[model samples]
Target: MNSDPNNQNNFEHSEYFDKENIHHKMEPVTAAFIALIGIFIFYQVGGAILTILIFGFNFENADINAMRLLTMGGQILLMLLPTLIFARFVYPHHITQILRAKLPQAKEVGIFIVGLILLLPLLQSFMILQNNLLEQISSTFPLLKQLMNLLDQMDKLLEKTYSSLLKSHSFFEGSFVVFLTAVVPAICE
Candidate 1:
């Protein structure tokens, strides 16, 4: 029956702010809406600025390296920056807790490697099946066949562009490429 606002025990026993099972202050639905809006805005704004800086009104073709950098940088900005902002300033959640992330033990890593090795044949079979299905569908529909050919051309062009960006002549360059393409994206997510 203590009527003291400053009593530490009061907060400990409160129903709304339970010390035992406190959760994120922001509602899950609100957080999801904010996340979607943040991503949309960040992608549109960041891509525009990058394009202006790199291309400068020349939309015909962009340098492969510049395009690669832009794509990676955009993802970091759109995904990682907003999440960090919300976690630190808005809701102030622990990074590990919010992300549900932890460094896996060596045994976990070994198990993952074994799983991938065991699944390789099945994964390959699925890829082949997918391609065969696409081919069959395209053959049945002339319009779809034309559309598929166009998509294939576009895919090849993109593949070539990405390959050009990924080509690294030296060890340091290769490491940088991996960092930009793999490490940075993983961290952003």
Candidate 2:
């Protein structure tokens, strides 16, 4: 019968805000959309401003190490931060559960490693076959070639960015590159 919505007893007894249960929070799709918007705003706007502040307008010509640091920082800020925020909004009290706040089992780790090793050759072979098929199809369809050209431009840009980020000047730089490309994304994505 408490009139105040902020009353602890009222919130505690409310089915929707039950502390013991993780349901009745925001819709998963709604939370996903919010996170997507956050990613766009953070990556496109905040990231651009940060880039300019760090390397000025000519960021393309910035030092490689600086660019690597920027890429890592941006991933943490724009990707991981938004994801955490999404968890907080959707599962307030159960954020850890939502984010899988636990170490993986050794068996799980082994399976993941073995899966990656086994999948690589299969994937490479598939890619070769796919490319050959696509080439044949594109030869008969000019529109497909134009679409492929657009995709190739995007792929080239991504490759250039990855290549730039992977460059290292020392052992420490190489270690950081691995952390940035491997560890950070493993946690973020």
Which candidate leads the pack in TM-score? 2
Tens digit per residue, CA lDDT, model 2, 61-102: 788877887888898988888888778877877775556444
Clashes of each: 0, 0
Model 2 per-residue lDDT at 184: 89
Give the Cα-based TM-score of candidate 2 against the true structure.
0.67
Superposed Cα deviation of residue 94, candidate 2 (Å): 2.4
Q: Residue 66 error for model 1, in Å?
A: 2.3
**Which regions of candidate 2 fall more than 4 Å away from where they truly are?**
1-20, 27-60
Report, for every candidate in turn, its global Cα lDDT versus the true structure. 0.75, 0.79
Candidate 1's residue-wise lDDT over 74-157, tens digit each?
A: 888777887777766444644444454546668989999999999999999999999899999999999999999999986886
Each model's RMSD to truth, in Å? 8.2, 8.6
Per-residue lDDT for 74 in model 1? Answer: 82
